[model samples]
Structure formats: C-alpha cells, structure tokens
Target: MLKPLPDTVKGPAMRLQHMVMTFRSALVDRLVAHDPALSRVRMGARVTLSILISIAALIAFHFLVTPLPSISYALAIVLSIEGGVAVRDRTPGEQLKTRLIGCAASLFCISLAALLEGYRLVADLAFLGVILAASLARVYGQRGFAVGMFAFISYFMGAYLKPTFAELPLAALGPLFAVTIGHLVRTFLFPEDWRRDLRAALKAMQGRVMDILVRLSVLSKEGRVTENDRTELRHMEEQLKDVVLMAEGLLPRQVDGTAHSDDDPVTALSMAIFDLHLSAESAIVQSLETPPPFVLVHAVISGDRDLAEKVAASTAVEKGGETARASAQALLWLQRSLQALGRAAGKEAGGLASIDDRVVDEPPTKPDFSWKNPLVRAAAQITIAAGIAMIFGLFLSRERWFWAVLTAFLTFNNTKSRGDAAIRAMQRSVGTALGIIIGLAAATLLAGHTVSTVILASACVFLAFYFLQVSYALLSFFVTIVLCLVYGLIGQLTLDVLLLRVEETMIGAVAGTFVAFVVFPASTRSNVDLALARWYDALGQLLDAARDGESRYRVIELSSRLDAAYRELTVAARPLGSAWSLVTRPGPIRQTLAMFLATSYWARIFAHDFAEAKKPLDPDVLTAIEEARAALSKAAARGSDCFATRKPRPVMAGNAAPAFRQGAAMGADRVANLLNRLYPA
Candidate 1:
C-alpha cells in the first residue's frame, strides 16, 4: 500500500478532485440536454465555413487563373451563405438540385438586372415585378422560396452595383463557385441525419425528464408546493414540449426508408414519455398529502432498476387515502415509463414511426389565390409595404434603398398578423440600433487590422446564423456587425454609413408595420379564435374516440392530432400573451390567457387518463363526458369566446354516481371546473 499523504496535501487534493468532478457532471448534463442553441450553433459553424471556403476559392482563382472584380467576391460570400441555408434538411441529391436551381435563378436575375440598368423607369418596374413574382413563388413551398429569395437578392445586387454587361461573365463565376462549395460543405461537413438527431433528442429528453423529476422530489421533500414551484414546473413543461416536438418531427423522416411494425418501439417510447410527463404533472398539481415512494424516486434517479422495482412493488401494498393511492399509481406509471425508455435506449430497437401514420397518406390541399386567402393577402400586403419602403428609402439614400425594401420584405415574411408584424418590426429596429452601436465600436478597433477584422466578421456571421431562430434582435445585431466589417474592408466604414443603415431599417420596419395594420390586416383575435376552435375540435375528436372505445391505434392517432392542434394554438396565442399585448391591454388578455392555460391543463389530463383507463366509465360519468364532448363540439363550431359570455352548464346531475377510477374522477372534476371558469355564471 502507498504511504499516507500529509493532511494539508490530502485536503487540497480532495478539493481539487471534487471541483473536477463537479465540472465534469455539469458538462455531461449540458451535452445531454439537447438545447436547441447547440443545433443553431452547429448550423452557424457550417454556414461560416462554407462562406470562408468560397471566399478562399475566389481569391485563389483571381491570383492564379483570371482577375475577378471585388463585386464577384462579395457575391460569392452572399451566395455561399444563402445556398448553405437553402439546402438544409434536404438529402444530398436534393441539396445538389436545390443549389443548381438557386444558382440558375441568381444568374438569370443578375444578368437581367444588368441589362436593364440603363433604363431607370424600366429597372424600377422590373424591381417591383421581381418582388411580386418572389412573393407569389412562396406558394410552391421551401424550394420556391429559396429560388425566389436568391433571385431577389441577385437582382438587388445587380441594381445596386450597376455592373456593365462586360463584367457579367466574370461575376457569373461567383454564384457557380459559391453553390459548388456550399454543396460540398453541407454534404460532407455538416450533413443532416435525422436518425442521429432523433437519438440525441431522445437522450436530451431523458435528461430533461430527470431534471423535472429531481426538482419535483426536492419540492416534495419541502412538504408543500408553492406558486413559484408551479411556475417553474410550467416553464419546464414548455421546454419539454419543445423537445417532444423536435423528436416527433424527426421520427417520420427516421422511419421513412426503414421497415417498421404497426407497434413501433419509438412510437411506444414517445407515448410512454408523454404519459409519464402527464402523470408527473398531475402529482404536482394535485399536491397530494403523501409523496411518492422516496426509495423509488431515488432509484429511478440513480438508474437502479432493481431497487426501483422493489420499491414500486412495496408501494402497491402500502397506501392510505385517495391521494395516497393516486401517488402510488403515478409512481407505478413512472416505473413503466422508465422501462419503455430503457428499451428505446437499447441499440437493438427498431426505427421510429410517425406520430400519426394516417396523416402521411392525406393529400395536401390546393392553394387559394382569392383575395380572402391569407397567403394571397400576405403577398399583397408585403408588396405594398415594399413599395412604400422604396419611396421612403429613396429619400434617405438612393443607393441604399434596397436595404429598406429588404427589411420590409423580411418583416412580413413569417408574421401571421398585424400584431406579429409590429412586434417583428420593433425587434428589428431595436436590434439594428444596438447593432450599429456595437458595430461602430468593433469596426473602429479593427480598422487597420485586416486579418483581425476578417476573423471578427466571420465570428459575427456564425453568431448571426446561430441566433437566427432564437432571437431576431440578436441575429440583426450580428448581421449589422458583419456589414460594418464588410464596409471597413472596403475602406467605406463611417458613422454616417452606420446611421444611414439605421434610418433605412427604421423606415422599412415602420412601412411594413403600417401596411400590416392599415391594409388587409390579419387580426390576432381572429387567429387565436381559429386556433382555439381547431384545438377544441381535435380535443372533441380524441375524447369521442376514447369514450367510444376505438382501437388503440385510432385513439393514438386522434391524440397525436390533438397534440398538434394544441401546439398550433399555443403558437397562435403567443401574440395575445406577448409583452406587446400586456403593454396595450394587460387585464383582459391576461385573464383570457389564464383561462386558456387552465383549460389546456385539465383537457390534457382528461385525455391522458381516459385513454389509459382500463374499465368502462360509470354511466353517470359517461353521460357527463358526452355532455362535455357536445359542448366542446359547439365551442369548435362557434368560437372559444362565445362561451365567455354564456352561462356555465352543469356537467352532471346533483345525484349522479361517482366515477369508477379515482384518476378519471379527478380529471373529470377538474375539466368541469375548467369549463366553469371558461363560462362563469
């Protein structure tokens, strides 16, 4: 045996070891958490790499083969970025095809813009025509959108630069080179693999579930759950929802080329995870007098299956009141869910399946081109906004008018309503202002250091793409910094240039928001009402299927649709519950949002419990469920707001018999209370 160390040395060594272990644990947790930020970061890296490689190739060609203009270099950088993003989520072959189409569109637009540059009136008309065509092209889906965007960007570049016909051939090489490099980088460097992504997502979900369980255990030990605890649980629930959606989205792709049985292991695992989440949420909300078995909870946390099963078995024999029994049942469900998770984690597990297989065969609806159609209206609104922006931008700076038009187009790109457009405009304006400030500082510091400026610009490009989905403000900030650095590279960096950008952005954002509000405006209220109606319709279908004892697969299909509808409703209601809405009308929106959330909670619980219920419901309970279903059907037909002013209806007779199962009984009562809240007398 080794000799004992000195006390002082031993103490420091142990402390250092503990620190290392803590750091390792935290790192492991972070890697396993599957935070969406990581995915964005990876995407940013890929795009930045593609840009760098394209630029490098352009430089090499200019030095060795033929002299290329500076405009070619700029075009290469922009096209590389665009091509990388456009090809995301496509197979290698599809990616190549998409790149080719984008390249062709870019070339055609650039050549056309160059040819028309001498005739000012004709060029302006062509610009407007391009905008209209691009807006309409979105109807064809992602591929169309990509091609349209590339064409628009190329036309804008040509119009702004006013390149001569002689320069067209050399400049044409930029897009071709960019597309080739981008395709190679995406296919080899950062190719998408849904199967791998699904596995990672599942692991992240497991980590998230464990985190929730740990937090619940801590809350249970405290003897009572506080409002803060409930709020935290709700936040965690949102995060869990994101992870579940990510996993579900990937499953269909994962199973596409593989053979799968009707009873897919991945589907079963997903159901188990969802059921466990519901059960855990119920335990917390119920605030049972007795907590779940401490030993079982610990065992599950520690991955001690033998210990967990032993504790679960023991808990079945020791129970007290209804709350105690409910707690025990929840623990049992948790155990089963853990087992299913383990099976999925095994390497021998089969491929995943779509959340609802029936949805796959359904034909897509034809696009509506009428005035009342949302897409048509959106296209018209954006085109109008672009026109207004163009007029104002010309007054600001004739050369930079395209910036304002770009901002206006982007403002309405993904917005659903006037409120959303306003919010997006605010975000963009704020982001641009902050970006200018920071970009000014960064550009000044790296003024004469070409390499440093290039490195910083590359970092900004990465960060801009990384936060593309996370925050519009952050994306705009980094993009502005990249622009500032670009200007610095060209020896045009100035406070005046930065300020002009800010002005153009503000003009564009304002124009977009104004048009959204004044033109065929899509109201947030209408969107929310429609979303709620669809959700209620889906919920009614699920409840009807469960009550009628439909096949398990049928019930699962309905439940999946309900889940999808609920997600859509949550997205649609975001503007109503946003900070903007709170600032304008806090009281009514808050109250309505509260009612919506409460109803969602109970509705989910009822769906989960009733679907899993083994025995037929009591006759009186069945009658109550039927009444609730009918009411929901009506709510779907009319609107959720219709129930707001209506008197509450009793779900059951005063002398009705009790429900057969305690869980189902509690769920029914909670749902009844939710309806009462929705339609208070």
Candidate 2:
C-alpha cells in the first residue's frame, strides 16, 4: 500500500501542479486567442442550410409540385435530421445513417398523427407530445435522439398540416429522394474523403515532427538549438494533438482503410520511431528543468554526423547486443514507412489518405453520462417531457409540436453548464426571430405567385449553401425569407400563419431552455478537475514506464496517456472558468501552475529523449533529471506559496559522476533562469 503525503507536502504538490497547468493553459491561450472574425469565417454563417443539396433539391420539388403541401412536410423532415447531425461530429457513414433514420421516422410519425386526429384533443397535442418524447429519447444517447427527432418532426408536421394518412407517402418520398442524393454528393464530391483526408494530414504531421527531430539532433550536435527553435518545436508538438483528433474523428468513417497490421514491418517501425521521438522530447524538457547527462546534451549539441552515429543511432537501434545490425534494421523500417506512404499517395491518391489501418474491436465509450438508475431513469425522463408537453398543450394552445421542438433542442447534449445551455438558447431565440422577420419581409415583397416565388426561393437556397459555414444566424435569416416568401406566393400568408410560427418558436425555445437549465447541468469545472487528475496520473505512468525500461507496450501506453491528457486539457480550455483563471489571476498561483504543468509535459518528453542515454556519459543527464524532479516535488508540496521567495536546494551527488553533476547543475540553472524570467518578481 502507498503512503499518502502529509498536508504540507500535498498542499504544495497540488499548487505546483496547478501552476504547471496554468502555464500550459496560458501557452494555449496565446495560440488560440479568440477572434470574432475567425469564428464567423469558421462557422460559415450557414445555420439555415439543410443537408446542402437536400435543401437544393427541395427547391426543385417546389417547382415540380403544384400545391406545395408536400414541400413543407419534406422541409420539416430535413430540418429535424439536419439538426440532429449538426450537433454530432459525424463520420460519413454515420451522417448518412442519421439522415436516413430521420426521413423514415418522420414519415411514419406523420402518418400516425393523421390516424389519431379523430381524438381531437390528442391531435391538437401532437406537437407538444413529440417534444416530450424526443427529450426523453435523448438521454439514451445520440442515436436514440436521432431516431426520436424524425418521429417527432413527422408527427408534428403531419398533424399541423391536417394531412390525411394517404398524403404521408408523398411527403416521405420527397425528403427521401432529396436526402439520398445529397448524401451521395457529400460522400463522393466533397473536396476530400473524410478518413483519407484526415490520414493524409496526420502523415504530413508525422513528417513535420520528423523534420523537427532531425533538426534537434543536428542543433544538439552543433550546440546551436536556440530559443526560437524550441518555441517552434513546441508549436509543432501541439499540432500533433490536432492531427490525432482529426484521425480519430475520421477513423469511424473508413475503418477498412486502416491497414497497419501488428506484423506489418512499416507499422511496427513507425510505432518504434514514435516512441523514440517522444523519449527524446521528454528528455529535452527534463533537461530544461534539471541537469541532464553531458553526453546526452552533447550528442544533441554536436553536428549531424556525430548525432547520427551516436545518440540517434544508439537510441533507435534495436538491441540484440549488435548496435550496427540493430541500427541498420531500424533505419530500413523508417525508410519503408516513408516510402510506402509516398508510393500509396502516388498510385491511389485518395486511398493513401485513409489510415484506419489499426482495428479497434470495441466502440469508444460515450464521454458523458451519469444515471442513478438506467431503466427507471429513462422512464422518468420520458414521463417528465411528455407530461410537460401534455400540460402545455392541454392548458395553452394545443400546439404540442412546440413542446417536441423545445424538448429536442434543450436535450441535444448533456451540457456542462447552465451558462452554456443559456447561450445556446439565446442563439436559438435570436436565430428564430431573425429568420421570422426575414421570412415575413420576403413574403411581402415577392407577392403571392407560385412561379416567381419558386425562382426566388431557389436563389436563396443557393446562397444559403454558399454561406452556411459563415454564420448560422445569416443562414437562418435567408432560409426564413425564402420559405415565407414561397408561402406568401401561394396566397397563404395570413396574419394567423405568421403569428402561429412566432408563437410556436418562442414557446419551443423557452421550454427547451428551462428544461436544459433544470436538468443536471454538467459543469466545465468538473471536467477541468478531472483532466488535471488525468494529467497527474499520466505523469505517474510515464515515470513508471521509464523506470521499467525498454518495452513497446510501455512506450505506446505512455504516448496514449499523453495524447489523452492533451485532449482533455484542450476541451477544458474551450469552456469558460477552466483557463480564464490565469487571465483573472495572473499572480504566483497562475504563473507557478503554468510553469509546473508545462514542465511536467516537457519532463515526460525528456524521459523519452534519454532512451539511448544508457551509456556511461548519460549518467550526468539522468542525475540532473532526478534532482529536478525532487525540486519540483518539494516545490509542489509547498503549494507554490514561496516558489519565488525560496531558493531550490542543490542536488545531492550519490553515485553521480563529477562531470555529469557539473553539466546537470548548469542545465538546471538555465531552466530556473527561464522560469524566473517567465514569472517575474
């Protein structure tokens, strides 16, 4: 059993850890400092967009159909599916499946709604009923909600349109054809294949990392790796996280494309190379904080020829007690991976981009879900949503569909905070109002004529697609105008219709917001805390792995932990309160935590870098790292209170070599100086 540290030690340790986190957060903040222009450009202003060509085809449908009844029904189905898909970061297959589910469910629900019309009160309650059902459905996960949304939208629209059961077939077909065609286009004609494109990007990132590594080796040999190079390397290192995320996101779409086999010569070699690189990085960061062996540093500071012959070759070369033979074998593997990638790209182009070579048998875990009871909980949720919608429908306007829409939107994700939910609600309300205003204006201007309205509607559809990435608001604005204008052209723009839409939208938004706020709000703070815990856990794992020495599993596990921690940190930073503390409190707490976490990450890399430092000259570097860890541990125990006030104690020389001790001390001093400069008095 492990003994716990005393409060005095624990307090400082936590503080030191916190400080490290702060430093890393600050670095990230500098990199991604928010810009309104960038957000607008990135979001693509396309909120009003249906499944791109899905909406486009809908326009064509309006031109073909004389009455326009089927068009509205189809549009509603499109909207439901689009809304569901929008929330998820979907792979191509998933996206297609979601759309299909929405289409089918909507059709069935609407037909059922028509059948139930005889029960006038239940018929009037259709909209609100769906809302309740959808809200309850979402607790089951994205897939559940996806199916629910289709059913709810179809039922609500069919009931409101007062369509006969027979009309449901036509309503369904319109959306089905449009959606199927649109997905084919998205899958085939998009600028890149989702998985393939992402893999290509990952390969490019690997190349970049390799280039940085080569440069580092050369710089170490020449003693010329400057602060600028270090900074650039750090930036490049961060980008690897992005590439990994992209690869993960795309992998689900092209599972078959991932061809890396356990026995595949290239894959095994690539894995080894990755481990070595990480080891090198860990060593460098450790050296920055503690004195590393002179030989290890010397190998880096020496020229390329020396580095290639010494540190690089020694670290990467396989060990069978035959250094040259191992180095040759390792070199051959690296060459093969690079050559294979290049040849694959040249011959098959898109096929090379798909790198889902590794098979993962189990599906990834759902990120957030906490239920006291599973079946009971789900039933309770369904009861609440349906109950609320029924009460509203019965007591107020019988427009039950409003309840469903509200329930769907509010329950979209297990939110981290009420504030986030509030923000989304605000966006929805604003978007809806803006859309309504635009629609009304377009109707009034275009006048009540089918031919002219269809022409104008098509133009709006085109523009909406072009700008969907800009701003959801802008997209919604255009869509609202087009649809309303078309309704007006049909001579159906009575004050009643306009008033109903506004009322329904408002009702849905308000109800949804309330439900979201009332439901257990997931706080970003908790996630941050969890991430910090994981970071510490990762640090511990990395240390153990290093101590255990040369094992492929150990190395892979370390890298995986590092990747997971980085992702968690990134997520924490995105939400408020996670990283804003640094900005709000730029004192020692912030500064210290920032430095500590950054150092921790660097420390892990340094450990990796010293993989080849088993030679006699490597002892000095290893001693320095040990000394640095001790200092950090001491500082952490003190809660970062006197990081500036107190001086770090000198490392004790046990079996440490004299030259190594001297080099390690020098390295530690430089790092201390850097920390002092970064924090200031």
Which predicted model would earn the best TM-score? Answer: 1
The C-alpha local distance difference test score for the whole of candidate 2 amounts to 0.48
Question: How many backbone collisions does model 2 have?
Answer: 68
Tell me each candidate's TM-score.
0.87, 0.57
Candidate 1 accuracy as TM-score: 0.87
In model 2, where do residues sit more than 4 Å from their true spots? 1-68, 71-103, 118-142, 191-195, 199-244, 247-357, 363-370, 373-404, 407-411, 430-510, 534-539, 550-557, 573-575, 578-600, 610-681
**Candidate 1 structure lDDT:** 0.72
Worst 10 residues of 2 by lDDT: 650-659
**Candidate 2: deviation at residue 209, Å?**
9.5
User: What lDDT is reached at residue 602 by model 2?
Assistant: 47
Query: Can you give the lDDT of residue 334 in candidate 2?
Result: 37
Residues 229-270, model 1: lDDT tens digits: 767876776677688778766655233333234366655655
